[model samples]
Target chain A: MQPAHSNTVIEASKLGLTFQTSDGPVRALSDVDLSIGKGEFVSFIGPSGCGKTTFLRVIADLERPTSGSISINGMSPQQAREARAYGYVFQAAALFPWRTIENNVALPLEIMGISRDERKARIKRTLDLVNLSGFEKKYPWQLSGGMQQRASIARALAFDADLLLMDEPFGALDEIVRDHLNEQLLKLWGQTNKTICFVTHSIPEAVYLSTRIVVMSPRPGRVTDVIESTLPRERPLDIRESPEFLAIAARVRDGLRAGHSYDD
Target chain B: MDRFRDKIIPVTTLLAGLVVLWYVFAVIMNAPVQRDMDRRAGEDPRFSEFIGKTLAQAKPTLPAPHQVATNFFENTFTRKITSNRSLVYHAWVTLSSTLLGFAFGTVLGILIAVGIVHFIALDRSLMPWIIASQTIPILAIAPMVVVVFAAIGVTGLLPKALISTYLSFFPVAVGMVKGLRSPEILYLDLMHTYNASASQTFWKLRVPASVPYLFASMKVAVAASLVGAIVAELPTGAVAGIGAKLLAGAYYSQTIDIWSALVAGSVVAVLLVTLVGVAGRIVERSMGGRPA
Candidate 1:
């Protein structure tokens, strides 16, 4: 259990990312600042081509920001990794096709030199957490798209990393499945008490799930607004249909549009 | 269901027709010849004895099919692996070279594939040359490979194994290169995001992704290795091998011996290929979760 006093788990200040294409340098993100507290569910919502994904990548140390710095658990992203600071769930499941569901979840543990008996126990626990307990021996291909994604989430949880960075983890699912996953995700977040930094383009999704929503715009992308949701702590499916949720979602949409107008 | 049934009917009909035709032709062909030999056997003792030699010589062409069956059963029953003249002895000799060549070839192929995958320049320079290498007739090069290896003081199994390796490695190299590069762009980006080291990405992702391709290529390599070993043997005129038996049979007009040796070579190749297929299934089952 984390102490209440120091809730800050991730901090990024004036983070910028620039890629050198054949034509010239293209800035993907510019001067973005955000901090994620322990047990916070933060969503990065933006239009396409905005740096929401890039920002998540920066936090994950997938991409190095051109300027500014980010820290995880009071250490730089690299140092935090040495402490096993986080687990990343990609847009696609990225499950190793040659591995069974159990083995896929056991990958990070194997890398960390965990013993077989303990690894097996953790695998079962994580799979159970994702409601995938019975699918342990099945291959990734044998599962449906939604199930594969859930299994991937289970894999991220298998190592017990405190910070979970997700890049559009549910973007590919249909609406009905997406809503179900979102409700499950909120429950998972509440139960695990792990800080989650999720990236998505859906405004309602951000408003429904996040404690705070960071809205971004494209073309040398930068954050425009960070809205702290006023929804009650005990969030459920009913809250998504509430006036408060819709209003916050509309605000996120306006913030996204405002960032786009400013770019022009 | 109809499609499957239709596909099988033609094959079954053709096979049944061929078997009937074979028995009828065998009787028609052998009767006249057998009758003339029998007539000569009655005419004179020396001629009859000479006729017996001709009948034995001609046995391979018409072999009553039953004669070949009897020979096979007799050889298998008593000679076994320990006997010098046994089919098992020749098979073992062939199998050793085939297996050695396969191991050597597979390792070399994987290394070359890694080099190709890692370096673009190597891919450009080596890929075309590798493909071109296959176009060079194995028959044309067999004697040269044998002679060169002999000149280098390499003999016995090494020369034959090297020949097999030369033939077997190309498929594995090409197949693995394709397999290693098969990861999707999104997956690559995901690994990049994780800050995965190159070796980490390789073992965790690339190597596992290449399993199907590696096994598929092994089937081709095993067959090629058997061909290489037999070809290598032909050039060396090795004292103890099936190839030497084939050559001696040809020289002496012992056509039955030559045909039987051909059957032996084919049987060895089949067994090696089947072994690889079985191994591929085991690996695929263990790794990919179930057999196809």
Candidate 2:
């Protein structure tokens, strides 16, 4: 086990969360202890109702934990959120239908009171980073589903926050487009060195992008395993066929299967 | 050509059908009155003579379509706009009140909607009252508005406008409430992540989103404003506007005059609604709303 280092971007101590519903109190998360170092890409892999998304929301301050404690950059989740510590990408693009691609990206900058010149420069830089520069003036509904999602990513990247909480950002895309986006996202992570906390259900995706993959289980939503990656940092799309990559993927698949017990 | 067949054909056919129905009704209603006239004159007329006389009665129970059409044209185009007898003059009097009242109503409604959306107290207490305001029949309320305003020595255009304001504000408030709250939860969460202040969220997000709803509500409101104006004219004993024309026509049994005034009112309503629609389209387009 790695010691709790000073460079840790996130730290949690036996974190737990329970949601009170009409049926009863549902334990969305339980006894989650983890620390993520700065500039590392981490993936949380789980099935439906496994609280992978819930954990991300907790980190983003969208949900509060009922037990234990969690901190981002040595501050409470709410304080970090108020300080503009991270950017979150939802499962869907969630772009405003009436805003142009450029304007959608500009939304955060404008809210943060960035000057007009700085906003313009950041919008250009982020859209270029997402390969959506030529389509800035187009409305969200005018674009293809993939392009819309890219625009949404550019919007999240516009502010250049050090932490990016992505909840299944490419989950809705076709395999080909998802692969393409995955390559681009890996390149982006290398270029920016941001600490990315990604949530996904795909085993390959978790093994492919993450420096460490946290496999989780449903029914009280606890972490089953955390696997550190041994693959090279500079990887191509075909690296999935490599023996080392497949070995990690097989381990992740076993972790998932072990967590998903069929008994009701 | 396809548009002509799809849209124009149905619309014109329906209109022609209505005109034919009106002519038929006019003949049936006037026949009894025409029979009494022949009996008094001791002139037993033939079928053609009786039909002609029924359609062209001096004081028919229901005037023929042609009679009302001619009266409307003469009063609208032949008479000078300054003339009291001109339908155009009366229509102008009512339209001014409608426009003024509609403007005030839209502002008031948007303000109320903003309050209801932002403040829980307003949402709980004020929203119910806004809805309850609409249930009180405008006809019953019109007279009291005029009476109260008259007691305060406020008369003429302002009182009639106040009545129009009362009738028009309800739909604007209701539509805006739905519109201002229309943003998705994801987008609202996006705003929250930015730590956007309430006013910031309002100006950058809520205001632009509420526009389409504003224009839709205004279209209904403009028509309602016109109705309130006409109704105000009825009770306040105003000597101008379509309402007064109807009142005067009824007092003297000049049914042709009543029908012509009604036609003028319809034209005004169609104009106002169309104007609002055009304004809405321009705004939504400017705000990046795609054409539906």
Q: Give Cα-based local distance difference scores for all models.
A: 0.81, 0.91
Worst 10 residues of 2 chain A by lDDT: A1-10
lDDT of 2 by residue, A1-264 (tens): 234477998998899999999999999999999899999899999899999999999999999999998989888999999999999999899888778999999999998999999999999999989899899899998998888888988888889899999999999999889889999999999988999999998888888899999999989999999999998788798999999999999999999899999877
Q: Estimate each model's TM-score.
A: 0.80, 0.98
Return the lDDT, model 1, position A174.
Answer: 93
Chain B alone: TM-score in each candidate? 0.82, 0.97
Q: What share of the true interface contacts does each candidate keep?
A: 0.39, 0.78
Weakest ten-residue segment in model 2 chain B by summed lDDT: B54-63
Please, what are the lDDT tens digits per residue for candidate 1 over residues B64-138?
344454555565457867786676676677778988999999999999999999998998899899999999988
Backbone clashes in model 2, listed as residue pairs: none
Candidate 1 wrongly placed segments (more than 4 Å): A1-7, A261-264, B1-10, B13-92, B114-137, B148-154, B185-200, B240-242, B249-263
Off by over 4 Å in 2: A1-4
CAPRI grade of model 1: acceptable
Superposed Cα deviation of residue B110, candidate 1 (Å): 2.8
